[model samples]
Target: MSRKENAASLVQDYAEVFICPVCGDTVEVVELKSVVCPKRHTFDFAKQGYINISTRSMKVNYDKELFAARENIIMKHKLYDPLHTRLLEVIKVEAANNPRSLLLDAGAGEGSHLAKILDQMKTVTGIGIDISKEGIRLAASKSEKAMWLVGDLANIPVKDQSLHTIINILSPANYQEFKRVLIENGLMIKVVPGANYLIELRDTILEEQKRFFTNEETISLFKQHYSDVQIEELTYTKELHQEELRDLIKMSPLSWNAEQESINEVRNREHFGITIDLAILIGKNR
Candidate 1:
Protein backbone atom coordinates (compact mmCIF):
# COMPACT_ATOMS: atom_id res chain seq x y z
CA MET A 1 0.00 0.00 0.00
CA SER A 2 1.07 3.58 -0.50
CA ARG A 3 2.11 5.76 2.42
CA LYS A 4 -1.13 7.75 2.41
CA GLU A 5 -3.20 4.59 2.18
CA ASN A 6 -1.28 3.01 5.03
CA ALA A 7 -1.91 6.04 7.20
CA ALA A 8 -5.62 6.01 6.45
CA SER A 9 -5.78 2.31 7.21
CA LEU A 10 -4.16 2.85 10.57
CA VAL A 11 -6.70 5.57 11.38
CA GLN A 12 -9.58 3.22 10.53
CA ASP A 13 -8.04 0.38 12.52
CA TYR A 14 -7.49 2.29 15.74
CA ALA A 15 -9.99 5.12 15.56
CA GLU A 16 -11.62 4.23 18.82
CA VAL A 17 -8.51 5.02 20.83
CA PHE A 18 -8.45 8.62 19.69
CA ILE A 19 -10.40 11.44 21.33
CA CYS A 20 -10.99 15.00 20.31
CA PRO A 21 -8.14 17.03 21.71
CA VAL A 22 -10.31 20.12 21.99
CA CYS A 23 -13.42 18.62 23.57
CA GLY A 24 -12.44 15.19 24.89
CA ASP A 25 -15.17 13.43 22.85
CA THR A 26 -14.52 10.00 21.33
CA VAL A 27 -13.51 10.23 17.69
CA GLU A 28 -14.47 7.92 14.80
CA VAL A 29 -12.97 7.40 11.38
CA VAL A 30 -14.62 9.29 8.55
CA GLU A 31 -13.89 8.44 4.89
CA LEU A 32 -10.75 6.55 6.04
CA LYS A 33 -8.68 9.73 6.01
CA SER A 34 -10.13 11.87 8.75
CA VAL A 35 -11.32 11.33 12.30
CA VAL A 36 -14.40 13.18 13.54
CA CYS A 37 -15.97 13.48 16.93
CA PRO A 38 -19.61 14.04 17.89
CA LYS A 39 -18.82 17.66 18.61
CA ARG A 40 -17.81 18.20 14.95
CA HIS A 41 -14.07 18.35 15.48
CA THR A 42 -12.01 16.67 12.73
CA PHE A 43 -8.34 15.73 12.35
CA ASP A 44 -6.87 14.86 8.99
CA PHE A 45 -4.23 12.19 8.37
CA ALA A 46 -1.04 13.50 6.78
CA LYS A 47 0.29 12.03 3.54
CA GLN A 48 3.48 10.97 5.33
CA GLY A 49 1.46 8.57 7.55
CA TYR A 50 0.76 10.39 10.81
CA ILE A 51 -1.83 12.61 12.49
CA ASN A 52 -1.58 15.91 14.33
CA ILE A 53 -3.72 15.72 17.45
CA SER A 54 -2.60 18.94 19.08
CA THR A 55 -5.10 21.76 19.42
CA ARG A 56 -2.46 24.50 19.54
CA SER A 57 1.13 24.98 18.50
CA MET A 58 3.92 24.33 20.98
CA LYS A 59 7.65 24.65 20.43
CA VAL A 60 10.38 22.37 21.79
CA ASN A 61 14.14 22.30 21.49
CA TYR A 62 14.28 19.08 19.39
CA ASP A 63 14.60 19.23 15.61
CA LYS A 64 15.02 16.98 12.57
CA GLU A 65 18.81 16.88 12.88
CA LEU A 66 18.66 15.68 16.48
CA PHE A 67 16.17 12.96 15.63
CA ALA A 68 18.23 11.91 12.63
CA ALA A 69 21.29 11.68 14.82
CA ARG A 70 19.28 9.63 17.31
CA GLU A 71 18.09 7.25 14.61
CA ASN A 72 21.67 6.71 13.42
CA ILE A 73 22.99 6.11 16.93
CA ILE A 74 20.13 3.71 17.69
CA MET A 75 19.72 1.71 14.45
CA LYS A 76 23.27 1.80 13.05
CA HIS A 77 25.22 1.46 16.28
CA LYS A 78 22.68 -0.79 18.11
CA LEU A 79 23.44 1.12 21.29
CA TYR A 80 20.19 0.14 23.04
CA ASP A 81 19.79 -3.42 21.80
CA PRO A 82 20.22 -4.95 25.22
CA LEU A 83 17.54 -2.72 26.73
CA HIS A 84 15.23 -3.51 23.84
CA THR A 85 15.73 -7.23 24.40
CA ARG A 86 14.90 -6.92 28.08
CA LEU A 87 11.77 -4.88 27.27
CA LEU A 88 10.56 -7.54 24.84
CA GLU A 89 11.03 -10.26 27.44
CA VAL A 90 8.75 -8.43 29.84
CA ILE A 91 6.22 -7.47 27.15
CA LYS A 92 5.99 -11.06 25.88
CA VAL A 93 4.99 -12.25 29.32
CA GLU A 94 2.47 -9.44 29.82
CA ALA A 95 0.86 -10.03 26.42
CA ALA A 96 0.98 -13.82 26.36
CA ASN A 97 -2.77 -14.32 26.66
CA ASN A 98 -3.87 -11.41 24.48
CA PRO A 99 -2.42 -11.51 21.03
CA ARG A 100 -4.07 -8.27 19.89
CA SER A 101 -2.60 -6.23 22.70
CA LEU A 102 -2.21 -2.45 22.37
CA LEU A 103 1.05 -0.73 23.27
CA LEU A 104 1.83 2.96 23.50
CA ASP A 105 5.29 4.52 23.39
CA ALA A 106 4.85 7.84 25.16
CA GLY A 107 7.41 10.46 24.11
CA ALA A 108 8.41 8.15 21.26
CA GLY A 109 10.97 10.36 19.53
CA GLU A 110 11.79 9.04 16.02
CA GLY A 111 9.94 5.78 17.00
CA SER A 112 13.00 3.53 16.57
CA HIS A 113 12.59 1.69 19.86
CA LEU A 114 8.88 1.06 19.39
CA ALA A 115 9.35 -0.12 15.81
CA LYS A 116 12.09 -2.55 16.81
CA ILE A 117 9.99 -4.07 19.59
CA LEU A 118 6.88 -4.38 17.40
CA ASP A 119 8.92 -6.13 14.69
CA GLN A 120 9.46 -9.05 17.09
CA MET A 121 5.90 -9.36 18.41
CA LYS A 122 2.99 -10.88 16.51
CA THR A 123 -0.60 -9.62 16.40
CA VAL A 124 0.25 -6.53 18.41
CA THR A 125 -0.44 -2.88 17.48
CA GLY A 126 1.63 0.12 18.59
CA ILE A 127 1.17 3.87 18.86
CA GLY A 128 4.02 6.38 18.86
CA ILE A 129 3.28 9.84 20.29
CA ASP A 130 5.56 12.81 20.75
CA ILE A 131 5.30 16.55 21.17
CA SER A 132 7.86 17.31 18.46
CA LYS A 133 6.52 17.58 14.91
CA GLU A 134 9.90 16.68 13.40
CA GLY A 135 10.17 13.59 15.54
CA ILE A 136 6.66 12.45 14.61
CA ARG A 137 7.37 13.05 10.93
CA LEU A 138 10.46 10.85 11.05
CA ALA A 139 8.61 8.14 12.97
CA ALA A 140 5.64 8.09 10.59
CA SER A 141 7.88 7.93 7.53
CA LYS A 142 10.02 5.03 8.84
CA SER A 143 7.81 2.90 11.11
CA GLU A 144 5.00 0.98 9.44
CA LYS A 145 2.03 -0.94 10.93
CA ALA A 146 1.76 1.64 13.71
CA MET A 147 -0.02 4.90 14.43
CA TRP A 148 1.89 8.13 15.06
CA LEU A 149 0.58 11.30 16.65
CA VAL A 150 1.91 14.71 17.64
CA GLY A 151 0.51 15.19 21.13
CA ASP A 152 1.44 16.21 24.63
CA LEU A 153 2.37 13.86 27.46
CA ALA A 154 0.53 15.82 30.16
CA ASN A 155 -2.72 15.65 28.16
CA ILE A 156 -2.52 12.55 25.97
CA PRO A 157 -4.99 12.40 23.09
CA VAL A 158 -5.91 8.77 23.74
CA LYS A 159 -9.13 7.71 25.42
CA ASP A 160 -9.35 6.66 29.05
CA GLN A 161 -8.62 3.01 29.91
CA SER A 162 -7.52 2.35 26.35
CA LEU A 163 -3.88 1.24 26.51
CA HIS A 164 -2.67 -2.23 27.52
CA THR A 165 1.00 -1.42 27.86
CA ILE A 166 2.81 1.93 28.04
CA ILE A 167 6.54 2.40 27.53
CA ASN A 168 8.38 5.52 28.71
CA ILE A 169 12.06 5.26 27.87
CA LEU A 170 14.37 8.08 28.96
CA SER A 171 11.43 10.47 29.08
CA PRO A 172 9.51 12.32 31.72
CA ALA A 173 6.43 10.61 33.16
CA ASN A 174 2.94 11.85 33.99
CA TYR A 175 1.70 9.17 36.35
CA GLN A 176 -1.81 10.55 36.68
CA GLU A 177 -2.36 10.55 32.94
CA PHE A 178 -0.71 7.14 32.63
CA LYS A 179 -2.96 5.56 35.27
CA ARG A 180 -6.08 7.06 33.74
CA VAL A 181 -5.32 5.78 30.25
CA LEU A 182 -4.13 2.30 31.24
CA ILE A 183 -6.47 -0.66 31.32
CA GLU A 184 -6.92 -2.66 34.46
CA ASN A 185 -3.72 -4.62 35.18
CA GLY A 186 -1.92 -2.69 32.46
CA LEU A 187 1.88 -2.57 32.66
CA MET A 188 4.08 0.53 32.58
CA ILE A 189 7.77 0.16 31.77
CA LYS A 190 9.99 3.19 32.46
CA VAL A 191 13.71 3.56 31.90
CA VAL A 192 15.79 6.12 33.80
CA PRO A 193 19.48 7.00 33.71
CA GLY A 194 21.77 5.56 36.36
CA ALA A 195 24.77 7.22 37.96
CA ASN A 196 27.37 5.95 35.50
CA TYR A 197 25.37 6.59 32.34
CA LEU A 198 27.45 8.41 29.75
CA ILE A 199 30.33 9.00 32.18
CA GLU A 200 32.80 9.32 29.33
CA LEU A 201 30.77 12.06 27.67
CA ARG A 202 30.40 13.91 30.97
CA ASP A 203 34.11 13.68 31.65
CA THR A 204 34.99 14.90 28.17
CA ILE A 205 33.20 18.24 28.16
CA LEU A 206 32.46 19.36 31.70
CA GLU A 207 34.92 21.12 33.99
CA GLU A 208 33.02 21.25 37.30
CA GLN A 209 31.97 18.16 39.18
CA LYS A 210 28.29 17.15 39.07
CA ARG A 211 26.31 14.94 41.38
CA PHE A 212 25.50 11.44 40.19
CA PHE A 213 21.89 10.47 39.45
CA THR A 214 19.98 8.38 41.96
CA ASN A 215 16.54 6.85 41.53
CA GLU A 216 15.56 6.72 45.16
CA GLU A 217 13.08 9.63 44.89
CA THR A 218 11.73 8.46 41.56
CA ILE A 219 11.25 4.88 42.78
CA SER A 220 9.55 6.08 45.91
CA LEU A 221 7.11 8.17 43.89
CA PHE A 222 6.36 5.23 41.57
CA LYS A 223 5.62 2.98 44.55
CA GLN A 224 3.11 5.48 45.87
CA HIS A 225 1.09 5.36 42.62
CA TYR A 226 1.58 1.77 41.45
CA SER A 227 1.62 -1.81 42.76
CA ASP A 228 4.12 -4.64 42.27
CA VAL A 229 6.88 -2.21 41.34
CA GLN A 230 10.16 -3.73 40.26
CA ILE A 231 13.49 -2.22 39.24
CA GLU A 232 16.44 -3.67 37.29
CA GLU A 233 19.80 -1.99 36.70
CA LEU A 234 21.86 -2.50 33.52
CA THR A 235 25.35 -1.14 32.99
CA TYR A 236 28.02 -1.82 30.37
CA THR A 237 30.86 -0.17 28.42
CA LYS A 238 31.02 -0.11 24.63
CA GLU A 239 33.69 1.10 22.23
CA LEU A 240 32.56 3.77 19.75
CA HIS A 241 34.21 4.81 16.49
CA GLN A 242 34.61 8.44 15.52
CA GLU A 243 31.44 8.73 13.45
CA GLU A 244 29.34 6.97 16.07
CA LEU A 245 30.84 9.28 18.68
CA ARG A 246 29.83 12.29 16.62
CA ASP A 247 26.27 11.02 16.29
CA LEU A 248 26.15 10.27 20.00
CA ILE A 249 27.11 13.84 20.83
CA LYS A 250 24.58 15.18 18.40
CA MET A 251 21.80 12.98 19.75
CA SER A 252 22.15 14.08 23.38
CA PRO A 253 21.02 17.36 24.96
CA LEU A 254 24.16 17.50 27.09
CA SER A 255 26.06 18.79 24.09
CA TRP A 256 23.49 21.52 23.46
CA ASN A 257 25.02 23.80 26.07
CA ALA A 258 28.65 23.04 25.21
CA GLU A 259 30.83 25.28 23.05
CA GLN A 260 31.42 24.45 19.40
CA GLU A 261 35.10 23.91 20.10
CA SER A 262 34.31 21.40 22.82
CA ILE A 263 31.92 19.52 20.53
CA ASN A 264 34.58 19.42 17.81
CA GLU A 265 37.12 18.12 20.29
CA VAL A 266 34.86 15.22 21.22
CA ARG A 267 34.05 14.51 17.58
CA ASN A 268 37.71 14.43 16.58
CA ARG A 269 38.64 11.62 18.97
CA GLU A 270 39.76 8.42 17.24
CA HIS A 271 37.91 6.08 19.61
CA PHE A 272 36.45 6.04 23.09
CA GLY A 273 34.71 3.71 25.50
CA ILE A 274 31.44 4.96 26.98
CA THR A 275 29.39 3.51 29.79
CA ILE A 276 25.68 2.80 29.48
CA ASP A 277 24.03 2.68 32.88
CA LEU A 278 20.24 2.56 33.14
CA ALA A 279 17.46 1.40 35.41
CA ILE A 280 14.29 -0.23 34.13
CA LEU A 281 11.27 0.23 36.37
CA ILE A 282 8.13 -1.86 35.85
CA GLY A 283 4.83 -1.29 37.57
CA LYS A 284 1.14 -2.11 37.35
CA ASN A 285 -1.82 0.18 38.03
CA ARG A 286 -2.99 0.03 41.61
Candidate 2:
Protein backbone atom coordinates (compact mmCIF):
# COMPACT_ATOMS: atom_id res chain seq x y z
CA MET A 1 0.00 0.00 0.00
CA SER A 2 1.02 3.60 -0.61
CA ARG A 3 1.94 5.82 2.35
CA LYS A 4 -1.39 7.60 2.08
CA GLU A 5 -3.27 4.34 1.95
CA ASN A 6 -1.32 3.07 4.95
CA ALA A 7 -2.17 6.17 6.94
CA ALA A 8 -5.83 5.83 6.06
CA SER A 9 -5.77 2.21 7.07
CA LEU A 10 -4.29 3.15 10.43
CA VAL A 11 -6.99 5.73 10.99
CA GLN A 12 -9.74 3.28 10.08
CA ASP A 13 -8.23 0.54 12.25
CA TYR A 14 -8.03 2.78 15.29
CA ALA A 15 -10.99 5.07 14.69
CA GLU A 16 -12.73 3.98 17.85
CA VAL A 17 -9.85 5.16 19.99
CA PHE A 18 -10.21 8.79 18.98
CA ILE A 19 -12.63 11.50 20.14
CA CYS A 20 -13.16 15.04 18.97
CA PRO A 21 -10.84 17.37 20.88
CA VAL A 22 -13.36 20.19 20.52
CA CYS A 23 -16.67 18.62 21.41
CA GLY A 24 -15.50 15.56 23.32
CA ASP A 25 -17.73 13.42 21.06
CA THR A 26 -16.72 10.22 19.28
CA VAL A 27 -15.09 10.82 15.92
CA GLU A 28 -15.88 8.77 12.86
CA VAL A 29 -13.51 7.99 10.03
CA VAL A 30 -14.58 9.70 6.79
CA GLU A 31 -13.49 8.13 3.50
CA LEU A 32 -10.20 7.05 5.05
CA LYS A 33 -8.91 10.61 4.77
CA SER A 34 -10.54 12.60 7.55
CA VAL A 35 -12.19 12.13 10.92
CA VAL A 36 -15.39 13.93 11.84
CA CYS A 37 -17.53 14.23 14.92
CA PRO A 38 -21.33 14.39 15.10
CA LYS A 39 -20.97 18.12 15.67
CA ARG A 40 -19.20 18.35 12.26
CA HIS A 41 -15.73 19.09 13.65
CA THR A 42 -13.39 17.54 11.09
CA PHE A 43 -9.68 16.71 11.09
CA ASP A 44 -7.83 15.75 7.96
CA PHE A 45 -4.94 13.33 7.62
CA ALA A 46 -1.77 14.81 6.16
CA LYS A 47 -0.52 13.35 2.88
CA GLN A 48 2.76 12.48 4.58
CA GLY A 49 0.90 9.97 6.83
CA TYR A 50 -0.39 11.47 10.09
CA ILE A 51 -3.32 13.38 11.56
CA ASN A 52 -3.66 16.58 13.60
CA ILE A 53 -6.28 16.41 16.34
CA SER A 54 -5.26 19.52 18.23
CA THR A 55 -8.17 21.71 19.26
CA ARG A 56 -6.17 24.93 19.22
CA SER A 57 -3.07 26.21 17.48
CA MET A 58 0.07 25.28 19.38
CA LYS A 59 3.12 27.51 19.75
CA VAL A 60 5.76 25.00 20.73
CA ASN A 61 9.49 25.81 20.70
CA TYR A 62 10.49 22.56 18.96
CA ASP A 63 11.13 22.69 15.23
CA LYS A 64 12.03 20.37 12.34
CA GLU A 65 15.75 20.94 12.88
CA LEU A 66 15.61 19.93 16.54
CA PHE A 67 13.62 16.77 15.78
CA ALA A 68 16.01 15.92 12.93
CA ALA A 69 18.95 16.32 15.32
CA ARG A 70 17.14 14.12 17.85
CA GLU A 71 16.48 11.49 15.16
CA ASN A 72 20.17 11.45 14.28
CA ILE A 73 21.18 10.96 17.90
CA ILE A 74 18.52 8.33 18.60
CA MET A 75 18.41 6.26 15.35
CA LYS A 76 21.91 6.74 13.97
CA HIS A 77 24.00 7.05 17.13
CA LYS A 78 21.80 4.66 19.20
CA LEU A 79 22.10 6.91 22.24
CA TYR A 80 19.00 5.49 23.93
CA ASP A 81 19.56 1.85 22.97
CA PRO A 82 20.00 0.67 26.56
CA LEU A 83 16.87 2.43 27.75
CA HIS A 84 14.88 1.04 24.83
CA THR A 85 16.10 -2.44 25.57
CA ARG A 86 15.10 -2.17 29.21
CA LEU A 87 11.69 -0.80 28.24
CA LEU A 88 11.15 -3.68 25.84
CA GLU A 89 12.07 -6.12 28.60
CA VAL A 90 9.49 -4.59 30.90
CA ILE A 91 6.93 -4.54 28.10
CA LYS A 92 7.49 -8.22 27.36
CA VAL A 93 6.85 -9.07 30.98
CA GLU A 94 3.78 -6.87 31.24
CA ALA A 95 2.32 -8.07 27.95
CA ALA A 96 3.13 -11.76 28.34
CA ASN A 97 -0.41 -12.87 29.08
CA ASN A 98 -2.16 -10.08 27.29
CA PRO A 99 -1.87 -10.16 23.57
CA ARG A 100 -3.25 -7.35 21.39
CA SER A 101 -2.09 -4.71 23.86
CA LEU A 102 -2.37 -1.06 22.97
CA LEU A 103 0.56 1.21 23.85
CA LEU A 104 0.45 4.97 23.82
CA ASP A 105 3.55 7.15 23.83
CA ALA A 106 2.71 10.50 25.36
CA GLY A 107 4.84 13.48 24.30
CA ALA A 108 6.54 11.23 21.79
CA GLY A 109 9.01 13.55 20.05
CA GLU A 110 9.84 12.20 16.57
CA GLY A 111 8.27 8.84 17.66
CA SER A 112 11.67 7.12 17.73
CA HIS A 113 11.16 5.37 21.09
CA LEU A 114 7.66 4.10 20.25
CA ALA A 115 8.75 3.10 16.75
CA LYS A 116 11.64 1.10 18.16
CA ILE A 117 9.44 -0.56 20.79
CA LEU A 118 6.74 -1.42 18.23
CA ASP A 119 9.37 -3.09 16.06
CA GLN A 120 10.02 -5.69 18.77
CA MET A 121 6.48 -6.37 19.88
CA LYS A 122 4.34 -8.76 17.83
CA THR A 123 0.84 -8.01 19.00
CA VAL A 124 1.10 -4.45 20.27
CA THR A 125 -0.62 -1.56 18.53
CA GLY A 126 1.14 1.77 19.03
CA ILE A 127 -0.10 5.36 18.96
CA GLY A 128 2.29 8.29 19.29
CA ILE A 129 1.09 11.78 20.28
CA ASP A 130 3.02 15.04 20.52
CA ILE A 131 2.21 18.74 20.74
CA SER A 132 4.74 19.71 18.06
CA LYS A 133 3.76 19.45 14.42
CA GLU A 134 7.42 19.13 13.42
CA GLY A 135 7.89 16.19 15.78
CA ILE A 136 4.70 14.51 14.56
CA ARG A 137 5.80 14.99 10.96
CA LEU A 138 9.11 13.30 11.71
CA ALA A 139 7.31 10.56 13.59
CA ALA A 140 4.92 9.90 10.71
CA SER A 141 7.87 9.53 8.37
CA LYS A 142 9.59 7.07 10.71
CA SER A 143 6.74 4.60 11.31
CA GLU A 144 3.61 3.95 9.28
CA LYS A 145 2.44 1.07 11.47
CA ALA A 146 1.94 3.30 14.46
CA MET A 147 -0.64 6.10 14.41
CA TRP A 148 0.83 9.59 14.89
CA LEU A 149 -1.23 12.54 16.03
CA VAL A 150 -0.49 16.13 17.00
CA GLY A 151 -2.43 16.80 20.19
CA ASP A 152 -2.15 18.18 23.68
CA LEU A 153 -1.01 15.91 26.50
CA ALA A 154 -3.27 17.64 28.97
CA ASN A 155 -6.27 17.06 26.71
CA ILE A 156 -5.24 13.87 24.95
CA PRO A 157 -7.52 13.12 22.01
CA VAL A 158 -7.87 9.46 22.81
CA LYS A 159 -10.98 8.06 24.50
CA ASP A 160 -11.13 7.47 28.23
CA GLN A 161 -10.08 4.04 29.58
CA SER A 162 -8.72 3.09 26.17
CA LEU A 163 -5.02 2.42 26.59
CA HIS A 164 -3.24 -0.63 28.01
CA THR A 165 0.19 0.92 28.41
CA ILE A 166 1.29 4.55 28.44
CA ILE A 167 4.94 5.57 28.05
CA ASN A 168 6.12 9.01 29.16
CA ILE A 169 9.83 9.34 28.47
CA LEU A 170 11.51 12.43 29.85
CA SER A 171 8.29 14.36 29.24
CA PRO A 172 5.89 16.18 31.51
CA ALA A 173 2.90 14.15 32.63
CA ASN A 174 -0.73 15.12 32.96
CA TYR A 175 -1.72 12.67 35.66
CA GLN A 176 -5.44 13.37 35.37
CA GLU A 177 -5.44 12.84 31.63
CA PHE A 178 -3.29 9.75 31.99
CA LYS A 179 -5.63 8.22 34.51
CA ARG A 180 -8.65 9.06 32.43
CA VAL A 181 -7.19 7.41 29.33
CA LEU A 182 -5.86 4.29 31.07
CA ILE A 183 -7.93 1.17 31.52
CA GLU A 184 -8.22 -0.89 34.68
CA ASN A 185 -4.82 -2.41 35.60
CA GLY A 186 -3.18 -0.41 32.82
CA LEU A 187 0.56 0.25 33.11
CA MET A 188 2.36 3.58 33.01
CA ILE A 189 6.10 3.59 32.35
CA LYS A 190 7.65 7.00 32.97
CA VAL A 191 11.31 7.80 32.42
CA VAL A 192 12.73 10.77 34.31
CA PRO A 193 16.21 12.27 34.27
CA GLY A 194 18.41 11.26 37.18
CA ALA A 195 20.89 13.55 38.93
CA ASN A 196 23.78 12.63 36.61
CA TYR A 197 21.85 12.52 33.35
CA LEU A 198 23.83 14.25 30.61
CA ILE A 199 26.23 15.67 33.20
CA GLU A 200 28.94 16.34 30.63
CA LEU A 201 26.66 18.50 28.49
CA ARG A 202 25.16 20.25 31.51
CA ASP A 203 28.62 21.00 32.89
CA THR A 204 29.85 22.13 29.48
CA ILE A 205 27.05 24.65 29.08
CA LEU A 206 26.83 25.91 32.66
CA GLU A 207 30.02 25.09 34.54
CA GLU A 208 29.26 27.26 37.58
CA GLN A 209 25.58 26.29 37.75
CA LYS A 210 24.88 24.05 40.71
CA ARG A 211 24.21 20.57 39.23
CA PHE A 212 21.43 19.37 41.48
CA PHE A 213 18.70 17.17 39.96
CA THR A 214 16.22 14.96 41.72
CA ASN A 215 13.25 12.68 40.93
CA GLU A 216 12.00 12.50 44.50
CA GLU A 217 9.05 14.79 43.87
CA THR A 218 8.17 13.07 40.63
CA ILE A 219 8.30 9.68 42.32
CA SER A 220 6.06 10.87 45.13
CA LEU A 221 3.57 12.21 42.61
CA PHE A 222 3.53 8.89 40.75
CA LYS A 223 3.02 6.96 43.98
CA GLN A 224 -0.02 9.05 44.80
CA HIS A 225 -1.64 8.21 41.48
CA TYR A 226 -0.55 4.60 41.04
CA SER A 227 -0.91 1.55 43.26
CA ASP A 228 2.18 -0.53 42.55
CA VAL A 229 4.85 2.05 41.78
CA GLN A 230 8.45 0.99 41.36
CA ILE A 231 11.46 3.14 40.51
CA GLU A 232 14.72 1.91 38.97
CA GLU A 233 17.81 3.94 38.16
CA LEU A 234 19.85 3.17 35.06
CA THR A 235 23.17 4.90 34.47
CA TYR A 236 25.93 4.47 31.89
CA THR A 237 28.53 6.54 30.11
CA LYS A 238 28.86 6.61 26.33
CA GLU A 239 31.78 8.00 24.37
CA LEU A 240 30.41 10.40 21.76
CA HIS A 241 32.09 11.59 18.59
CA GLN A 242 32.18 15.24 17.54
CA GLU A 243 29.11 15.09 15.28
CA GLU A 244 27.14 13.06 17.83
CA LEU A 245 28.14 15.60 20.48
CA ARG A 246 26.90 18.40 18.24
CA ASP A 247 23.58 16.64 17.66
CA LEU A 248 23.23 15.91 21.36
CA ILE A 249 23.61 19.56 22.24
CA LYS A 250 21.46 20.77 19.39
CA MET A 251 18.75 18.25 20.16
CA SER A 252 18.56 19.05 23.87
CA PRO A 253 16.82 21.96 25.63
CA LEU A 254 19.93 22.49 27.74
CA SER A 255 21.59 24.25 24.80
CA TRP A 256 18.50 26.28 23.85
CA ASN A 257 19.55 29.29 25.93
CA ALA A 258 23.33 28.90 25.49
CA GLU A 259 25.30 31.18 23.18
CA GLN A 260 26.39 30.01 19.75
CA GLU A 261 30.01 30.47 20.77
CA SER A 262 29.53 28.12 23.71
CA ILE A 263 27.84 25.54 21.47
CA ASN A 264 30.68 25.81 18.95
CA GLU A 265 33.19 25.27 21.74
CA VAL A 266 31.43 22.07 22.80
CA ARG A 267 31.15 20.94 19.18
CA ASN A 268 34.90 21.35 18.61
CA ARG A 269 35.72 18.79 21.29
CA GLU A 270 37.05 15.58 19.70
CA HIS A 271 35.31 13.22 22.07
CA PHE A 272 33.31 13.48 25.27
CA GLY A 273 32.04 10.83 27.66
CA ILE A 274 28.45 11.57 28.60
CA THR A 275 26.32 10.04 31.29
CA ILE A 276 22.88 8.54 30.56
CA ASP A 277 21.40 8.41 34.00
CA LEU A 278 17.62 7.93 34.12
CA ALA A 279 14.99 6.79 36.56
CA ILE A 280 12.33 4.50 35.12
CA LEU A 281 9.13 4.49 37.09
CA ILE A 282 6.76 1.55 36.51
CA GLY A 283 3.28 1.92 37.88
CA LYS A 284 -0.16 0.36 37.59
CA ASN A 285 -3.49 2.11 37.89
CA ARG A 286 -5.10 2.15 41.32
Best by lDDT: 2
Predicted candidate 2 versus true structure: per-residue lDDT over 1-286, tens digit per residue: 7676688787788778888888889888888778899999998889888888877887998888888898999889999999999999988886786776789999999999899889888888888999998899889988876888888899888898988899999999999999999998899999999999998888777646545667889999999999888889999999999999989998898887666787788899999999999999999986
Any idea what lDDT model 1 has?
A: 0.86
Q: What is the clash count for each candidate, in the order shown?
A: 0, 0
Q: Mark the regions of model 1 whose C-alpha exceeds 4 Å error after superposition.
A: none
Which TM-score value belongs to model 1?
0.96
How many clashes does the backbone of model 2 have? Answer: 0
lDDT, residue 188, candidate 2 = 93
Model 1 C-alpha RMSD vs. true structure (Å) is 1.4
lDDT of 1 by residue, 1-286 (tens): 7786788787677777778888999888877677788988888888888888876789888888889999998888999999999999999888887877889999999999998899888877898899988899999987786898988887887888888999999988999999999988899999988888998887777554542457788878888888898999999889999989989998987787667787788899999899999999999976
